[model samples]
Target: MSLAHLVPAAVALVLSAAPAMAQEAPRWSFAIHGGAGVIERESLTAEQDAAYRAALKQALDAGSAVLASGGAALDAVQAAIQVMEDDPLFNAGRGAVFTAAGRNELDAAVMNGTDLTAGAVAGLTTTRHPIAAARAVMERSPHVMLIGQGADSFAASVGLEQVDPSFFFTERRWQGLERALRQQNLPIPERPAGAPGPQAANDLPAPPLNERKFGTVGAVALDAQGRLAAGTSTGGMTAKRWGRVGDVPVIGAGTYASNRDGCAVSATGDGEYYIRASVARDICSRIHAGASGQIAGQAEVDDALSLGGSGGVIVMDLQGQPAFAMTTSGMYRGAVSSSEPARVAIYGDEVLRP
Candidate 1:
């Protein structure tokens, strides 16, 4: 064949390959929150700020590794949350706040969007990783939620890690508990016997009220296979009493995902108000009803704000896009996607990319 004829044939061949190349690209994406509330620059020292950012980055890396390998969205979300849950920097597991009874009662939920199956555990005091316990509930039990002693029992039955409640102790959280109870004119309960005794003065006596008002850790992810999953873990409110439960263990409240809706949402903040607004489910619902994820996130959070809720939500769509909305001054949040680098920001004025 002549050189001109060969060139035309090659051009057509390259054009045909373009579609296949595009299809081969991974569509994975992920986002996480270490909680959302009135965080101020003045509240954290330079060192403390760096530590928080590092912790968030670690969580992003954990999830990103899973998604990059074409893992299930549920696994990616769980992996990200487990990192934060083990870190004392976040308010979920190790650093969980104390209750009025001087105990750490955790709550968590996991949702598989592909089938809409979900599992949750509330007021669980011994599970080392509540997110894992939540997943166990979904996979091993017929129920959607298990709580308190029952949840703890179920978790152990499923071979989930069980720890002494003291494993959750952190001086900062203890200080926060003392301050919260003092503000309420309540007596301080004795710390658990097995927990380590207080040592240094490195802890904040009482963080700002806004910061104390809310704390949680959560994640939402879209996997390479286009599945969506979400999970949220929380220490609940400081000084909560009489077996209190929050939105974290409530599917469609603090965490919701739906493949049919093409979205997954995870929320952090004032659980009471979030439950009322149905923030997580509401955001995905609006998207299913034709609203964009960004629009849905902000609008639903606005509704929660109207009712005096202060918190934030992270939303991820099937296309590997993420959206965030918060009524509070700041949220410890971050995102990673095929098209975006891992980035985190604490303040609302910060660029949305991180």
Candidate 2:
């Protein structure tokens, strides 16, 4: 063969190998949040701060390990959130706050970006892992959400593990509830208030209530196939009453994922404001409209703050870019990507690099 023929063969060989190299080096990333609120450095003890950092790093490692091993984004998100759910440090799953009646009711949701399908469970009292039940609702049941006894029933029928309600009890959450009730000057209820009929044993506090700690947990990820997924879980606000449900189980409010838009988001904050703003979906929409992940996230959060909402969000784009923004004092957040080292931050001053 002449030199010209040899040159053409070499170029063809290089072209054939390029796609394989790209496929093997898939860009993936993961991010998670324990919650967002008035987390002040002066308020937290060194021991408490260390514990939270360690837990955040552990969750980041769990999810990133899944992505590093070529797992699906949905799996990575679920895995990371499950860790937070199981940890008593966050206001989800095992550490859920108590209702006015001092009972634990949990809520969770999960979304798949590939199809935009979602599942959620709300007001669950006995399910072991509400996030897993949410996934079951997405994968097995035909419904997008299940609540209260119905949700618990569906979770049991689906073979999800059930635990005694005591499993969710934690001293810190109990104290929070007590403090909220004291602040409102309302007596602790002997039982959860029933549907409106007659006055309850204790009068419910009026609206314009004091701010309570919102400890919702969430995770978002972009996987090897460039797919996105998001999940969120919470025990709702301390001293929540009347079987209240939050954005944690509301699609597009607390959780959103869109491969088409190249974004996935999970939010933690005031559930009502988040739902009103459609914060998670709005972030994805902004990103689709050509804003970078950081810009989109911060913009949506700014809007929420304008409406008197307080909280934080963690977002991941298809390009493996991650951003976390909050209107509150701080957010318990962390992230990891194929191109960057793991990072965790609590205060606004602790900036995370891309």
Candidate 3:
């Protein structure tokens, strides 16, 4: 062959190789939440509410950047949760709710989809951020779930920062607990004090009237290496009984990820129902079994609500598709993808509306 012909052929081969290499390299995508639900209009002033949503956006942007820069999915998930914890708006880290006993206890979990490896902490009182502790459990501990004092010790051993227990207390959350307790003590009038038919009863404790929803925090991300990961953090249920554990620290119930399948994070309402439903992993399995991510996720949410439960989720499938669905009137959700910016909402309808 002539020298010029050989040169052109070599150049063409090199150009073809470049696209192949690009295709093989890792790409990233991610979505996150402070929590999903209906926030009462009264609880958040326009300005305070805007600040909360903005914090969520900042976290999403930070995590997305990490994933885009070739960071691991685990890193993205934890980073996002950390921001939520710091914000004191959503019930995860620093702003976690007070227990029935008037103490703040936090829980968190993280999982790597590539291996179905998971780690979690429950009833942690001193860890500054439970998500970081959860990751440390995954990376350093021989066990998958740790609790209470032991979880704190493990976090310290692994170089995670510890703060005073008071560091987690928020005046509003403490007052909320007081309100819930006061409602529990109200007496019902037997005859409605004037007029009534059968006479209604105030048997159950007053329902939580907080503007913010069950503000658990979580993230799912596809890393530059194409691995999937998910993490969840929570203050647990408002006015939760002492030692009461919810879905937040449980693997499949609250948070689940399988790189071989997909990644999911669930904010379980009626934790009992979510535990029964195994909501998080079920959604991912449906997607893995050939359902569209949106279809599978929405179906699961509907199923949960149909059973008289309510909550929502944010997820990223193995194909890097993102989906959000809620069983309640709304789910506070946001995402950063090829689609749009990471915005926040008190109502899912507002966020999802066209």
Best by TM-score: 1
Q: Which pairs of residues have clashing backbones in candidate 1? A: none
Q: Alpha-carbon error at 115 in model 3, in Å?
A: 0.9
| Alpha-carbon local distance difference test for all models | 0.82, 0.80, 0.70
Can you write out model 2's per-residue Cα lDDT over 1-354, one digit (the tens) per residue? Answer: 111222232233223222243443338888889888777787577877888888899999999999999999989888988899888888899878888888989999999999999999999998989999999999998899999989999999989899878777665666567778998898875433332223321221211222365778999998888889999999998888898888889999889998898899999888888899999999999999999777678778778656775777888887776777776667788888786667787766566432
lDDT of 1 at 68: 86
Candidate 1 lDDT, 122-239, residue by residue in tens: 9988999999999999999999999999999999998999999988988888878888889999999998868777874343344464545576999999998889999999888889
Residue-level lDDT tens digits of model 3 in 77-96: 88888988876667877778
TM-score for each of the candidates:
0.90, 0.86, 0.82
Residue-pair clashes per candidate, as listed?
0, 0, 5
Model 3: C-alpha RMSD to truth? 13.9
**Displacement of the residue 337 alpha carbon in candidate 3, Å:** 3.0
Among the numbered candidates, top lDDT falls to 1
Off by over 4 Å in 1: 1-26, 200-209, 352-354
Report the poorest 10 consecutive residues by lDDT, candidate 1.
1-10
